[model samples]
Target: MSLVFATSNKNKFEEARKIAEGHDLELEHRDVPYVEIQADDVVDVVKPSAQQATELLDSPCFVEDAGLFIEVLNGFPGPYSAYVYKTLQNRGILRLMEGKENRRAEFVSAVGYCEPGYEPRIFKGKVRGTITKESRGSGGFGFDPIFMPDLGEGGTFAEMSTEMKDALSHRGESIEKLVKWYVRNNRADGDRNESDS
Candidate 1:
């Protein structure tokens, strides 16, 4: 009936709730201090955290991780987006792009889910865009103000409303995939229960 999402980011918590609501499901948020392993791939980074989180909570839980990769920078912060954000923030990123001609980039998100007896399931999402010339708008977080997605009218993620951003976000897309998996499994589970009954 409910799923647990383990993350420290309240922004992620809110988006996961929206994703669940969109699919007629309930999601509970917990900032479980699960260990996140540093890795080259997003999936690898998130799965261990998911495993530890579910074990700690003894419940079906998921962990989401994301990154912003820029083409010009040769993916300088592919799996290290969080660290880059903490160190460089937005202005530093813009400075890195000061004279670059190639501005292509994308945001990638990976969601990992786990239960006690099964392997963690991984779902991923990506959104293509470019780094803006300067920060724009006043919403969203992290690199939102500097990264403009290709989905909308040349607006940064920070410019879009939560509803608008959710519609085209990497997190939203991954959550959509996750919700589909949940729905299919839930239906199969209900069918099994019915047969048993």
Candidate 2:
């Protein structure tokens, strides 16, 4: 099976490819920018975008949105994580954690898939960990250097390689869930048609 992920982010696309390979499927990347609405959950934000991308591209596609939710901040920067990363960056985020004890944080990803005739399906994954006091590595983007997963040695996402991070990333997990579900449902090319109003 082959499908396109509605994103130009190389990191995300690459991760999808890796996960797809395990499922005996092919994953490709495409640029499909959509109006990302401010929503309380990542599912709401991704569903519309996924549907719009399928409409524009006329292909089976999925859109992903991931956020960094800090416990100390009362889940702040949850839906606004992208905006916060753009402005505050890693340094500013560390500063916000200065002299703070509760550094628990979770990285959550929601992936929405849309076919022409089917309702968008949302798959979600989450990784719970603590915020590092300082940035650690130079490999990843966004809050990778600060967000550590509770998986192995407790290293920051940036500190891990693409393969290592993909093994445990929220986005990777979500993509895998989608692929598995699609396969179980007997998905095929052109299985669904566009809905007419």
Candidate 3:
């Protein structure tokens, strides 16, 4: 069974597709736009989106929500990371971090899956790190260049290759959980074709 990943981000979908491939699962991308609720937690934001996507597409699907939480700012853009990225961008965030002694932060990802008429199942992943003084590499997207995971060998996410970043990323961890579950529960009954919706 091929499950659809409902998201409008081609970058995110491509990253997820790579991860799913490693687990012998096929993931289809559906650019199913849904309303993201204003919630303090990524999981809360994802659940309704997942349900809404599944309903709209009439298929089993999952939605992911991620955020960058800066300790000094007390999670300034915690649940509004996308909006912040749009309005502030990395430079704006750096401006906010100026003269700050504390650089601690974390990236959190939540994946919510739902089937028709069922409650969404949520999986979460987090990577603690420090915000970079300035953007680093040119890879990845959004805040990747500005966030350095503690486990990423001191390199900002954009500084690493996709495989390297995925190994230590919040989204990678969350998607891994979802893929594992699919391997155990959906593989036996799934189709092997890969396609977009």
The top-ranked prediction according to TM-score is 3
Runs in model 1 with CA error above 4 Å? 187-197
TM-score of 1: 0.92
Model 2 alpha-carbon miss at residue 102, Å? 0.2
lDDT of 3 by residue, 7-121 (tens): 9899999899999999888899888868889999887798789889989998788999999999999998998999999999999999999999999999999998888777788
* lDDT by residue (tens digit), candidate 1, 54-129: 8999988889999999998998788899999999998899999999999999999999888775668788999999
lDDT of 2 by residue, 16-55 (tens): 8888888888887888767789997887798788889989
TM-score-wise, the better of 1 and 3 is: 3
The whole-model lDDT of each prediction reads: 0.85, 0.84, 0.88
In Å, residue 110's CA in model 3 sits off its true spot by 0.4
The per-residue C-alpha lDDT of model 1 at residue 104 equals 96
By lDDT, the better pick of 1 and 3 is 3
Task: Write down the TM-score for model 2.
Answer: 0.91
What is every candidate's alpha-carbon RMSD to the true fold?
4.8, 4.0, 5.0
Q: Give the 10-residue window scoring lowest on summed lDDT in candidate 3.
A: 188-197
Sort by lDDT, top down from the best? 3, 1, 2
Candidate 2 local lDDT, residue 88: 95
Clashing pairs in 2: none
